[model samples]
Target chain A: MKNIRMKVARTEMDLSQEELAKQVGVSRQTIGLIELGKYNPSLNLCIAICKTLSKTLDDLFWED
Target chain B: MKSFFQRNKVKDERITNLQNKIYREIFLIVAAICVLSLIIKQLNHGYSEANIWTEAVILLVSSFYYMIRSTGLGIFSAEVELHNQASKRSMAFKNIVFGLLFGIGIGTFFGIRSAVLYADSTLQSIYYFLLVSLVSFIIYIPFLIVVVGITYLAAKKRSDRAVEKELEDDQDQDEHK
Candidate 1:
């Protein structure tokens, strides 16, 4: 259930969880939780994360 | 320009969640210590109303401080709304239930204390406990219901207004942009 795709995208962008969280106006722990599949973010937050990572929701959040 | 308090305020949801969790734990620890101390005092020197005053004051002050802060931050109303929505319960009903439970807890505590202190025989103690508990419950239930219900309504109104203002501000910013 971990968001491996999102983690990959973030690493590819050379962004740490803290840096990505700052960009999304959230805490590092929130980003970590999302990646760890421990938290389900609001659509607004999801959109914000997608925008920051330059990825679509399907690319990062969709379960195949 | 950000005020000193505003500048240092934490805006992150996760941090706020963690802080609330920690605060609850700390409050529980303090409450346990106060109860332990009260028990120790009662055992050593018998039941004096003065012995309870310190613990009562500490508990009341902490509760009031938390309520004020949560209300100011709109967290109290939001939490109440969330709980009511999730449980599919009306706010008034929930408040009444809360009042009743609170009354029962206080009544039980006072009943036990009075029974222990004033009753000479076991039968008398049982009689005293029931009488005192019933009286305390009757006195506190209505008072708490009215007070808590009014406070919740007022806080919810304030929170709604704040949310509206924030939406208007956002709309204004979008228009300006």
Candidate 2:
């Protein structure tokens, strides 16, 4: 499964990868890897990231 | 399986490397001491001191026993750096204990020989006491230093781990809040 692209959500919130990862309890490298499709964040991490970005999981993580 | 520990491969490798280094150092020291003892015997008494070779042989055999016992744990056991901090500490403690034993054994051997040859128990007793103290201190003091150093570093590592765990816990609580 793929998460919906986070670039748009992050841009909407004006948050950097560092800011998002800190808010999501993950390293910045985790954020970078997620964005680059190198790693898939867990469902919990996805939810956390979405919450921090003020986006619903459906908005940020649902690919279809 | 991706356990919490599995995430830190670098840390694991570093720990293994440390254990292997310690093992190698211990092996070298034991080997060197045995060789030195043989050299001393050869120099002082010629090849007639074949029994010193026997002592060297025993040292080699015991070293083998230790290696075999340790190796069953893993490859890193073949060297010093691979041992866990606790294992290293225990080894240090064991070394100090054994060093004292060796000192006493040597002193007693010499003391008994002197008493038998000279029939002077008082002189032999004094000689044994002095030799035992000297040998024991010589063997144990350096190892005591190493034990102290290793203990300090191990404590530091443990504290660092505790701090990291606390940070992780705080982050978890904050995320929940």
Indicate the DockQ of the complex predicted as candidate 1. Answer: 0.04
Kindly list the per-residue Cα lDDT of model 2 for residues B91-158, writing each as its tens digit.
54565566556656655665555555555577676776666556655766566556655654454454
Candidate 2 regions with alpha-carbon error over 4 angstroms: A1-4, B1-177
- Name the best candidate (by lDDT): 1
Say which candidate scores most in TM-score.
1
Error of 2 at B100 (Å): 29
lDDT of 1 by residue, B39-147 (tens): 8998899879987999989988988887777666555655665555457777768887998799889999899988999999999999999999999989987888888
> Chain B alone, model 2: TM-score?
0.31
Q: Is the docking of candidate 1 incorrect, acceptable, medium or high quality?
A: incorrect
